[model samples]
Target: MNTPTSTHCLDWSSKPSFKPRILALAIATAFASELMAAQDSTTADKTNVQDDLVIYGGTYRNTATKTALSAEETPQGYSVIDQEELTMRNADSVATALRYSTGVNTELRGGAVTRLDLFTIRGFINYQNSYDGLQLLFNDWNLQPQIDAKALEQVEVFKGPTSTLYGSMPPGGMVNLISKKPQQDATHSIELATGSHSKKEASFDSTGQIGDSDVSYRVIGLAREQDSQADTAGDKRTLIAPSIDWQVSDKTLINFNLYYQDDPEMGIYSTLPAAGMFRDNPNGRFDQNSFSGDKNWNAYEREVTLLGYKVNHQFNDNWTLLHNARYMDATAYQENTYTSYLDTDMRTLHRRAYLTNETSETITIDNQLSGVIQTGAIEHNLLLGMDYQKLTSDIRYEDNAIAALDLFKRNNSLVDRNTLDMTDTIYSSDFTKKFEQTGVYLQDQMKIDQLVLIAGVRYDDYKGSESGKKYGVSTDTELTEEHVSGRIGALYQLDSGFAPFVSYAESYQPETGVTRNNEEFEPSTGKQWEAGVKYSAQDGRLSGSLVAYQITKDNVPTRDPNGSPYDLIQAGEVESKGIELELNAQISNNLMLSAFYSRQDVEVTKDNNGLQGKTPVWTPEQTLSIWANYDIYTGTLAGTTLGYGIRHIGKAQMDAMNTDTVPSATLMDLSVGYDLAGLSTAASGASVRLSVNNLFDKESYSCYDSNNCWFGAERTVEASLKYDF
Candidate 1:
């Protein structure tokens, strides 16, 4: 037996270089001087330096521009899902909340793997997420952090290559989870819910000021338990979040937040053999609710803790300083048993088991200086910022062969956990990894009458090293990367409430491994071109956007035919082009509507393995969703609300060869709610709601890949009671 040792490190190669640092400083100094010189020429009125929409009665701010700009004026495409909509849909997870959003594939791994929000954006996997305005650094491990929807104020989705404002990210897009902060007024609410699969949950939210001081506090807590869709598995979770706000002066404010979550049991991440799930089998069809793992040998547990703070200081009416930071520690462990393949009989499935232990620690910080200025009738919102992020993680994996299962005989007793071997094998190993990135960026949003112009640039540097034993082999890899990303866009607004916009953006993501020739892999880079038109009703009751985009990514990694199974080479490129449309409207005094549609085409333009021109797996060609809500205000059914929704996903390729496909599916959802106050003034602050998802039980496969098929979620019914004061 051989003992394995592993270590990884990431650091700056040498002393800080002066060229980039000087350049960044010079740009900021120039902007500051121009703004100050024009200050005396113009009044300090905010409307002269910035755009205002308060008169419209509704304003939507976004992070797409690194400043407070309404979505209609941001030039790029994005979406916002507020808390009221979340309640009406009864969304329990991030993916569920985004199910009706455009350009997102939210059911990739289906319902059993709710532990992580696995999804695709614009045909590419988007694994990075942000909290507030800062990123939650994560690695390519199984230790991802999850934030409960109950503690969030809203969810924001920004599409296309977004590295100009954010340091590094996927070409497709990114998601930002906005936490519920302390409000000026006091409020309190408590809710109890029961749902399908014996699900039970309780939660509460309380916020108010600290006596008469200039301080406020808010606390949120939740507890839930439920049986998993798969047998022999279950889900349990506990979450608590506390926050405080302090207004030291009229020009300065600070906020502190703490989040903690524990999941004693996360449902199994298992898949069924495609032979029975998709193809014909003599033993008949596989049950979507069947368990593929042993009850005594399956488990997944995780715990996460995060602490963060935000500060804002106004140095006058023209300039402000903003800073934010966060620290995170998370750990996860999973033991799973899954099928490998079907036997010749098409009924006996070969099985295997694996165990994984992962832990990670991360720190991120961002600082920015924003200024509003006017220069000869041209107003500008300028931002200059810098950010740093570091992540350290350790992961260990072990595999073992398990007894086969005969689907027709229904004999699970043949497998005995105590009799299995636990010795080291060729597939067992441990690895340690560390990564760090530093970036500086500048952006300016300029407006001259009805014309808005926005341009931004960013520079990022990354360094890392990994030394470990993987697959019974010693490995050492080192990587260093530097990239400059940028974005430019222009939008023109007309008095008729129509805006036309066009933009170009670029992104680069660092790859962390070596190629077959022992050379480090190059970073994958992407470029996108987009054009769109947005319509906003002057009354602020209706808004819509239609956009078309084309994106190309190079340096994609693919299997190396001449090397071992684990070897890879950066010799592939992919292209994705799509159109997206979204609308939100208050059709009448009591009726509201939301709808989204997306159509895309993805292809491997270049590859070493005869995969060129083939469509990628898990990427559907089209998707559509629509939701509507109605309320009765003056009738026997007064205080009653009704909601209806429909979703559809087109067929998608199941393999790189495009030899098989996952059929299309359509699902419907319904909800009803009533205020108890109608019964008596004594229940003035109480209400009840019932929601049903997948009303028809739509039985189908969500996705199929790597010789496995995932079953879609079944029909679910949930009811909740709430009280507020």
Candidate 2:
């Protein structure tokens, strides 16, 4: 890892520069335009039509006749959340922004600082986060929502198995956050916002040329403080980030970025009382004192730093080399306390304190050679590349007191210290985990008449180790697996307005853990096959896709010791089949809509414990979401917009035993906003938005963990004033 001081140095004097030249023939042409036009008797074209739109960092684009095709077109499913959508919703966290995305589940624990928010995509959990295509690895699951949404250009979710690119990941998917980069021209903005729940925030962003040179840079910073609707837990955060780009002699470009974040804490709430417990005693409240001793002391503290550098060089036009490096350090400390109320006067006191410190360093160098070759009546775009990644996770745990206690409501406090036995010593343990992966891939795109064909293949190798506090007691293992993961697809354009395509692809994930005999286990594998149809307008104002897929996982680990939950052995298989429909369109000049629906059937195909035919826990059978926005009128209400949305989650099983379930529920949200001048001081050129969430105040329970139920948000009104410059 590079030290902070070494990463900040500038070597501007050692770089080259590019110069532009003008031709005399161009000047002469301008002078003879009128004469030449009259002689030719031809009119110049006036329509503004763009045939290609580059996505910059990625091979995909929005302008391709078919969907954008990269060097390699894998069969995995992915979604992108752009900046415009983020701004419209004022997304504060990744969970909040991706709540409606298909094949994703977000779990929010009670409290501000101690929130246990988990993100699972396609049933895979990716604990590692990435920024601008670089991985951010930390041992603990402590993630800060302080990441400024305004500083991101887009959020990409890659579904299915993805170990080929990101080494150690759950079967789910990955979330990549692309940060804003410097543009060609100067752009600056200062945004101030204030809303309900005592929310206060400020953010600033600026990007422009560096001095009088062609180089450019961008800086973004944000700070926020807010109180929550929960009992006593709120949140406070601060973030600072900056990035730079240097166009050294055109062929060589350098980009660098640095960021830091700080968050104090949040709170958590206990589960809802059991059915009988709540019905027998209507006013009997589940002990909410599970966090730290004091209501105000249940807090979480964290600090994170991310530094990355990218160097791209062009060797002629057909071949280019890209080298990227990133380093991250993150640490967190959290305290949680909750009480189990057996009755009004009897309860069990529990408190947990967690601390984690982790660091990750990675470097990847890929060389791609792309060229067109003609053979008889066919043409091909061929590409070849090699990639590598190394990831390591160091985790430590401390469990102080796991004792039970009785509580007698003394002064309204949930716990009675006189009846509880406490311990002063802390028990600690440490584990260091490391993973390494490398792959080589090749792809080609063949064009024949009106049909476009795409194909690719990749070979990968992975290895890792898990070490303990006592170094010699560690275990090491290697994963030597080769599989063909690629896509075979063809696009046939029926006309300019309609086109249909079909594709087949494969994906895989590596498993991590030791077997019953203390030997490392083999990696579990998954495969998926999908077919889809898509439609889009030539003007790019509307687009939609309907897809159907079947995915299966083999070598699933099952519990070996009869009823032992900790002993896992490979004795089961699982499969999932689903269909999804999505639409994004601008119906009119002032109206827009985005909607999605998914129906899934997932089951444990075979298991030793008679779990076959059981639905997967937390996997809802169906989900639907829609959002619509419309501008009211012109003139004084020209910028006035009204937005409404609804989300529905189908009933799902809550336990592996399949004996308990959580009912399906629907939620609604409404918002109105207007942009007008001089409504009040500090309000000129500003916009005011009013929103009501959970509008009907429906007490819906999304999930329950062992009788600890979680309820959806309550009816709440929030108003915000935003000023942009």
Candidate 3:
């Protein structure tokens, strides 16, 4: 066995202006002679489309060919949102970036300082988050995009009951964030942006070699402050992240990452009843004082560290082995207020602080052997591998109280006293919890003629423990479960540009709560089957895909009459079927367009609460997104670009009864930018961009659960500047 050394970084910065200038002059000199032909706009359109640049699949390579081929590919639906799309959309936070993604929902709470966003994928809610393939240990809401969009290479969304590979989670997808690694060569850039809602932000990123021996490092930092269109609410955030990569030897590489973030509590702006009814009030005003008392004082502080090591060795040209291992630790604290119709006039002050510690390490050893067996008639690529992962998490919580008046009218100018009421009204619970999980997987890939096939299977074991007080009584419980999951699929390419594929996969999620009768429920299992067709141009410039999928989950836990509020064991069975279509093409060198459309039917097939026919609360039936950008110049004026986009979300039911619902809504945005050369004191290239959001000033709701609801932002405008050297 031998290890592989670090490879040089990839670069994409190149510009040639002379050729465009010469072509421009020639066209201008022949303008009169070609006037008659030019008069026909159709002729110009044909010429322009031929000159456009097509980005078939953006910058990331599709190397998961083996994983994507299977009769049952572990039956899960996953999607990758790349850096190019994130940058083009100017997403400021993780929640905003995933807004239009299929089967994903976001919930925003509190003011800027105490803002909490949650994502539910395919009827599953995820409170635990991960970064760089490692779990981020925090229970309270944490904003991720604050870390700097420029620092992330891509965000992978793995959907439909994925606890077999992970340890514990809601019945949703997992979002794996991939961070930018240190580049072999030096590169630097700076960005300054000002946008609607009085928002201002500045960020910088740089990478280069650290020392003489093949050691490289990268650092990214960002600071942002914005006032909300709503009164008395906004957010301010600061983040710093740095990473280093060292090539210890030909077959060994080590990487380290450190990150820190600070955010203060801001006021919470929420909708209020027109006069007395919660759901009946449609055009209700935002109760700026909804969280007035001590609850209004919310804030979050977080820190995380990650260390990783990778080793690869080529036993020979026909066989190889690869291994990767990582460790991570993180923590966070938050406080807010809650109010109910029972005490509508008085806010019930509640304080919550959660601390989590997690560590995970994975090792995979794979051998790939290939040879031509029957001359040009038979070829094989065989793969054999073993995979292992161990993860543990410890969580603690604290609850406190403040006077109703103090919670409804909090003053951020000063810190309020920590008054302890010790009375029956004051409630507090302390808990220390731990969870462990392990998984081993094996996979194989084979090719014959023009057909490709892939297969894989994994076995997972999970255990959890909770030790704390329940209703003033000491409580301790332990739970365990195991599952075997796998996937298989095949792909066939036709002579033209068409390729059809089919796959089947199985997934599992660990159960977190017991049944009303005190019996621990087994892990929930999900099975998925899918088929799709893809088309692409010969040059790989234009491509499109149409896919249909169905998923079913069984063995869900039911609610307990005496269960805690946080206990979310499944109540019954759920089934979902959906279709998605995506298209990407470069109409011309100066113009490009991308679009996606999805429709899903999610229902609870079996439940204890008579909720079988109800629609999932946050699962929108339809979602659509489109974006197009055009460059105004080809050479010296090439920096000018104009862009516009729109997102539409279909109506969604809010409650199990399905009587109350949030209607479908559409939002539009526009942007324009110009690049200036040799005008910056610190760099040679500078650009300024202006954007308008919700151009129609639509007043609509973005999300609503039974107990809480959020309104989308109104009309807002912002401008930004960037300098590169």
Candidate 4:
């Protein structure tokens, strides 16, 4: 076992010379702009400032980028879900809010039992989720928390490999959650909601300036408890987040935030036998709400605390500096029993119970300097950034055999969850994993009148170590890796609000697997080439993008079933080619529309065991979603609004071997809202809305293979009442 030695630790600590050089370069670059600013006394800036609605209603412009290029000018595939859209859909989790995103798929691992949000972007699974442009870590092996979307101003999905700006990520893409910031004008809202499955929820949010002291505060809190559609399963959550902004001086500002979460006691559901679901069955399909696992016996509890801060300073009108950091501590314990596999008879199911405990801590910091300058006839938007991320985790996994159940005679009360004891559980494995990554990136978005050129490059250093007792044997290993990634693109704008662009991006993802020859597998690399056209109405009421792209990943790791366990092969390659179209428009004073269409073909281009040319699991060939809302403008129904949404998912294969395929599914959602003030003067600031999901009660399922499957959501009706003061 090659454990990370003390010498390696020394090597990790020996890379600080780059920092001072970067700082010095940033300073020199900012000074280089002095003559340009002095030369051009009058330059009409077509850019948005800090306080502007960088993300105004359905606007493609975003402040999250460290540069001045909006979505249209960035020359990459992107999607944004504003607060108004999420609120209208009544989205509760990050996954729910992003289901309509092009080429995206979300999964709930253990069904209603473990309602954590997991996702696959494009054709690859990703674990990198960002909050307020910073990393958010909530992982316990396969278990992760479902981020609350209620406190977010918007969610941005960057398609393709984004490692040039964001550090070490899955080849697919990333999700960026933008937190709601403190506002200058007073804003406050209180809401109460209830829905099917005996759900009850309440939330409060308020933001405004503080007593004219050049300070502002925003606080958001929510509590919810609900019964799961799965039998005997229930989940509860409580969260509080308080943030503050202090304008220390005219050119500098400080921001701080604290978040606390107490989420415990959620069930984790896996699945039933394929005999009843996919293949010929001795018995019929199990009851949709039947209890396969004892909800009380299975416990998934978690708690998390996060502290973060940011500082921004403007040295001059052309340059600004920003520093942001965050630290998180998360702990969780889980014990659950799931069907191990199907029995020979196919009518009875066997079970296995597992117990695990996890504790993880992470720290991330990013420092950036962004500026705008001009040289002759060219305008440059430049950003330089350095980031560091570190994480350490400890986990314990154990297993035990559990009694089986007769599929034909299933009832919640049949299993006495209270009598189950963990005392007899056998310890199986314990391990600790630690990871560190540091990156320095720079991007320049240059504009020459109607033409914009975007380019970026990044260098990354990574090290990972794992130590544990496996199979009653002690083992430890370490891997050190480094790589460079970049993106380049150009966008040409026409006089009629149309933009045509072409872009290329690449990524490097390190792996821990070693080959039979004891040689570590090389990092997987991803490359993409894309071309698109964008349109933005001058009034900012309409935006759209039509993009065509091709992406390929190489050096993917795989195991040959016909070979030894240690025979790991790195000769795997996969490719995804797709087209995406997105549109958001406010056609008239009362009508709003949002729609998207994505068609993808993901296949293994190179592999062993006849796996070549096969479709991987969870890659849907087509996905389409559309939503429209219209508000009554006058007369008797002046205060009323109606909304309708439709979603379609194309067929998908179950595994790399293509043994089975899950059929496509479609769903519909409806919403209605009315302002109470129009009905009576006493309720001036009160309003009510009702939303129904899966309006037709469709039976949809997501399958990973023949043995593993997930049932989709059932019909649900929820109503919310809100008051603004």
Q: Which candidate number has the best lDDT?
A: 1
* 710 Cα displacement, candidate 1 (Å): 0.7
Q: What's the number of clashes in each of the models?
A: 0, 16, 42, 5
* lDDT by candidate, in order shown: 0.77, 0.54, 0.52, 0.72
Worst 10 residues of 2 by lDDT: 8-17
Q: Flag regions of model 2 displaced more than 4 Å.
A: 1-53, 56-76, 108-117, 138-148, 162-172, 269-297, 316-319, 337-379, 402-427, 469-484, 516-519, 557-571, 678-685, 715-718
The RMSD of every model to the true structure, in order and in angstroms, is 5.7, 10.9, 15.2, 6.3
Q: lDDT tens digits, residues 485-512, model 2?
A: 6546676544664445555545554555
Candidate 1's C-alpha runs over 4 A off are: 1-61, 410-415, 558-567, 704-706
Order the candidate numbers by lDDT, best to worst: 1, 4, 2, 3
* Candidate 4 deviant stretches above 4 angstroms: 1-64, 108-114, 138-140, 143-145, 411-427, 513-519, 557-571
Give per-residue lDDT, candidate 4, residue 614. Answer: 87
Lowest summed lDDT over 10 consecutive residues: which window, candidate 1? 1-10
TM-score of each: 0.91, 0.79, 0.78, 0.89
Model 3 root-mean-square deviation: 15.2
Q: Which digits, one per residue and each the tens of the lDDT, describe model 1 over residues 1-725?
A: 00110000111111111122344345444544443333332222212122331111111125687677788888888888889888999888898998899999886777676787867888877656788877876656567788989998888999999998887787888898888887657999999999998999999999988887767789999999999988778899999999987655555556788999999999877677666776777778777786666776678899999998766555677776666778888899887766666688987778777777888788776777788899998999898888777777777877677888787666544556677764586767677777777788999999999999999999998766665776676766767788999999999999999999999999878887776567777788998999999999899899999999999988776555466545667657889999999999999999999999999999999987787898877789999999999998987788999999999988899766788888888999999999999888999999999999999998667544534667888899999999999
